[model samples]
Target: MTALTIRPLQPGETDLFLSYPFPRQPELWESQRDYVALLAAKAYRPEHTWVAIRDGVVVARACWWTGPEDKRPYSLDWLEAEPGPGQVELGTALLRKAHETMRNDEGRKPDYHLFLPPGWRDDAMVRVAAEARLQTARNVDLALFVERYSYRWSAEQDGLPDRSDRLEFRPADDAQMLVVLRQVLDGSLDAHDQRSVAEHGLDRAAELQLEGLYWFPSPRDWWQLAYTGSGELVGVIIPARNYDMPTIGYIGVVPSQRGHGYGAELLAEMAWRLNDHAPGEAVGADTDFSNVPMVKAFARTGFRITEEHLVLTDTAAGK
Candidate 1:
């Protein structure tokens, strides 16, 4: 038996990669092809896509990607291996090789995102495959950092809830926004942002959070701060466009102001703001699965779970 050989996809191998059968999902080939092409045309490079071969047969493949303006890879988005004897071992080896090639001495592994359909947990094969993939990445020192339920809201859903109209909603300047972000950082249910605050100080974490929001299509004026009639800070809601659609970029209530049903109010305010900006367009939001309160808040605001995702990152990042 020939030993496995793992390496990145070479130049001019996009066609080969696209043609490879993706384990079990034959119906998704067309969509996957289009996505792979888009990535290649944007941030994809030979070194960012990897494949594992045994006796010259491709057995596993993986790829990393970045946003259009990003200078380096941001995440590992694709990993698939043939399901056969020793499949787990091959998948683990492939992921390990990719991490070694991409990560530096700091052991910074790019975030890995996996989207699964709703109710995947009930399907035995689906659950097993998902667990195997996660464990494979874990073998390479990446851990499951967070799981988020993707939610969507349309104008057809329940109209935005009405709370205290006296609670003023106003556009916040950068300074004020940063202050609010800092105040809510400690008790934030956002696993990624909380982990960022823990690993790097609040300042660095805030910078990263702001960096992510910069991708929104909505302008700065769309970012808002909510306060009381007496000028007390209630919370902040960032309703902006992501990619092409309107989204609740971030919404949080001040730690001292939580538990007063402020979170649902904030989400409602965000939905109203986005509706005003892009009338008749759908709005989207994601909440960590562990954050039951926020999830319920989203539900109360008419956002339904549309999908679920598993996000993995370097284990050290969680420390």
Candidate 2:
């Protein structure tokens, strides 16, 4: 057997990366065809894509995506291998090598995210394909950060949850909203929030969140501060647009405002706002499974789970 070689893709090699025969079992968000379509928009860069070649045939491939305004890759969305033996090891080496090259002296390595169909475990083919890539990440020193549920608000299927009139929403800029964002992090059960606060401190975590929300293509005026009728603070709701659809960029309640059934209401308001802006369009949302309240809020607000996400953060040095 020719020795395996792993490296990032060079210019004009998009087709080469997709040459691997990934079985078309279950439909996923990271479908190769869809990714190829996104390539025209520059959502992916060749330098950030990698493949493991054995005997001149692509056996493994990993694709990373950076935000529209980012210069470097942010997170990996696709990790796949041609169906056959030794594919797991091939995947592990490819990821390990690719991580080091992509980091390029940056302190943080890009994380990996997988969007699998709901109840994917019940399908033997999907189960095997997912586990193979997950095992590769574990082997390369990436830690499984969280399992999150991806939901969609369908106008026809989910209908619309009634918007409560209890809370008053006031338009606020980043400066005013910053304070509330910090307050909500006090006891956040969201896995990403917890990790950010712990590793980067509350101020940084809150700022990072604001940056993320700002990154969306949503309207600035849509950011509103939720308050009680008498002027007490409840939280914030930012109905925004992601790449493919409208979404609730954020719906957060301050620590003091917990347990008031505010989550469901806040979520409902977010959806209504989205509906007002993008009529007849679906709204996407995600919440870590650890965030029971958020999960409940999603369900209560008529958002149905369509996909399960497995998120892994890379802590390994680019050696």
Candidate 3:
């Protein structure tokens, strides 16, 4: 019997971190030079990435990443382990060891978010890779939080979503916006929001969601609160963009107004507004798969399934 060794990469040990003995499916990261650039961009740091080695060979590696302006890691999203005996235990130990240090530094462990292609379970290679990481996460006390369904609309293919006819939208300032943001969380279908509401309460939950929406590059004023013919509030919609693509950032209906197909109305209005800004460009949006109405709304708005994001979170850490 042998024990696997766990440790973080020392500064400038890019190659050593890359020495793990398995090929990544979808293979979306780091050549040595590109990794150097990511370090420079503050997207990744050596000490935040960890690996497990036995007999001088790397068997498992876990990487944490941050937003462009963030100094601390935001998510532990990439993980890999060689397939063999004790592989699961080795990977679990590796993640637990890295998380122990990270939690002490950041006051919490970041969630594990893994992206899978559509119909991933049908693909042998992808399923194995996904399962290995998922099992490791559970072993480390993380739970399967939710599966977010991703939808995209292309002006060139799917065309624009229908403009809202029943609702009039007007921009809300930060203070006024907080009102609707809080109201929408009353009976929210969003798992992240539910968790935030459970742990942080309603006001803080809305504030947290608003805080995340601000991280996008889109103008803050693009957020609009929708109202009916008589000036009654319906919901809120945000047409925004991230570093990657144009997006329908946030769309929520207040608890009192959930049943009138307003979610789809908000989705359509967001698409129209975003298309106006990013003309001829594709737009992306996501909602929890459990939110059936929102999922149907994406279909009604001419969006198609592109990919799904599998979000995993720690029970010990909320949001």
Candidate 4:
């Protein structure tokens, strides 16, 4: 095996390092350069991007960011390495260099995360991660691709039943939207989400621009709350666009209101509203894979699993 020599990418090396992703079809350089430029524009430190250079050729590349504009601590993305005799070793070394650069040297280790595509789960690079002890965090980030959508378009996919005549469904303005957003996230979800919510409330979470990051049509509405004959927040669904598809961003029935099928009804109502208001593509959303109730609720309303995601975490050294 060839020895791996990984280090921080130097200035002016962008063109060369960016071209490494495409051994052939170097035309990809245009798109790749655009992406690198975007990251560089917002990077807290220019050295965040790293490259593994061996024998004067860049073999691996990983983009890194710290305390990016949003509340997100840091992120590493667009990681790719060439298929070479020492690619795995080179990639691991490059990753280690990144960790040390941010966490050790810069003291910026505020729980960074890497979202690896499922196809790379069993790669030698991932094996190095496990040996380094970066514990896999809670919740798989499942997704349903737009292409695999199998649910038939139905008119029944619109509006909630006025069963509990006392409750009303009205489009919410930004001010009225605050109330529904308050209870949007229940801190009881998972270790990761819980920690996040516990530290940063829903308002702060929203400020993270999760919705803005998604491609969705909006003028999002906080569907009127469901109250019984006696007014109370029984159920609520805040629907919006995710990748321009009808996305149920937040739907919850107070624990006291569960088991009476209110959760399912709220989801159904949201689906209908989205179909009616934003009648273009499809409706889709994601919940933790373990959230059987939420998953089942979507399924009952004609949504299906279209993609699987595995969330992996590893130590700085790839343990």
What residue runs in model 2 are displaced by over 4 Å at the alpha carbon?
A: 104-106, 317-319
- List TM-score per model, in order: 0.86, 0.93, 0.87, 0.57
CA lDDT, candidate 4, residue 125:
58
lDDT of 1 at 27: 21
The candidate that wins on lDDT is 2
Error of 2 at 170 (Å): 0.4
lDDT of 1: 0.76
**CA lDDT, every prediction?**
0.76, 0.83, 0.80, 0.51
Query: Which tens-of-lDDT digit does each residue in 1-319 have in candidate 3?
Result: 5777899889878888767667556622221125566667777788878888888888888778777766678888667787766668888889878886766233778878777777888888778767877888888888888998777897788877667788998988888889999999888888888888998999888888888888887788898899998899998988899766799888899888888888888887887777789888889888898998888888888888877688887777522
Candidates 2 and 3, the one with greater TM-score = 2
- Runs off by more than 4 Å, candidate 1: 25-33, 40-46, 104-107, 156-164, 215-217, 316-319
lDDT of 4 by residue, 107-155 (tens): 4333433333233346665444422222212111111211111232333
**Cα distance off (Å), candidate 3, residue 286:** 1.7
The true-versus-predicted C-alpha distance at residue 287 of model 3, in Å, is 1.1
lDDT of 1 by residue, 1-319 (tens): 7898888877778776665564564322222445555565665667787888886677888777755565667777777788766767888988877776576324587878776767778877777777767778887778788899988897757566665576888887777778788887867878877888998888777766776777765798888888888988888888888654798899888888888888888888888778888888889888899998899898787888877888887876423
How would you encode candidate 2's per-residue C-alpha lDDT over 79-192 as one tens digit per residue? 777767887888888887886667622556778888988898998888888887788888887778899999999676688899899999999878888888999887999888
- Residue 191 in model 2: shift from native, Å? 1.1
Model 3 gets an lDDT of: 0.80
